[model samples]
Target: MKKLVLLLIVLVFACKNETKIIEKPIEAVKAKAKPTTKFILETLKSKGFKTFDYVDTKTKDTVIMQQYFIAFLKSGPIRNQNEEESTLLQEQHLAHLGKMYDLGYADISGPFGDDGDIRGITIYNVPTLKMADSLANSDPMVKSGRLQIEVHPWWAAKGFSLR
Candidate 1:
């Protein structure tokens, strides 16, 4: 009977120790896991993106700023296309913009509601001005002389969304 009790006690202790061992590794994994902001910054850095960090004075929160390119779509010298040709070029232009967004090159693109020289804007997420210019100039509207591209380097906080 004493041996049986001793065996039971040993089993209980063994189980308890096993549980502690398993739990420790889990805690270690939790500790090693990176926060979302850190992961984002690391990913941006890995991709060769130009980034800087700053602390907001009011909130004391770290903000990650990245260099982005903004392409201004302006009225080109030639706009004498017929209605059909113009419509086709407009459709192609929209498709190109959509492709850029899908490929993670452009973040947002939209046309202005006014009749002005600056017809619209596209914010490219690429790291270089040259790349942004190439993508913007590839638009069918630009190729057809219905629009022109003027690219400029812009900076904005990463992981932000438009309200």
Candidate 2:
């Protein structure tokens, strides 16, 4: 009985100290653990952006930066079209926007659901406000005096990108 008791204690200690590893392929493990931010950074890098670089700052610290511009579309009071004409103009406007998107002149755009004067917003990849205005003015809606644009520059830290 004493020998049986000793064997049980030895077995318990051996099992408690044992190390178990459920083997998984390294690639599988990595795929499961990969960060979304890493994928976003890689996507941004693929987009021809200088995602990470040091810049001298007034605060005596080098800073990493990324830049973009946003254009705000505001409703205009100059629409002289009836309901049917307005619908046709809207179609033309959408077609013009699709062409710009295909040309990569506009990044992303969407309309607002509010009843305010603000109509829509578009984020542009153009370098200057003049370029942004040119793109905005090229829109059929703007040319027809149905919309106006207000553009602003936006900046962010490196590795932070819209996915």
For all predicted structures, in order, the TM-scores are 0.80, 0.57
lDDT of each model, Cα atoms only? 0.94, 0.74
For model 2, residues 25-116, the per-residue Cα lDDT tens digits are 55568778845555655676676544454545666544555455678889887878899979988998888778777887776788999978
Tell me the lDDT of model 1 at 114.
100
In candidate 2, position 104 carries an lDDT of: 77
Error of 1 at 156 (Å): 0.5
**What CA RMSD would you report for each candidate?**
3.9, 8.8
Candidate 1, residues 84-154, lDDT tens digits: the string is: 99989999999999999999999999999999999999999997888999999999999999999999999
Total backbone clashes of candidate 1, pairs 3 or more residues apart or in separate chains: 0
Candidate 1 least-lDDT 10 residues: 34-43
Candidate 2 C-alpha error for residue 58, in Å: 24
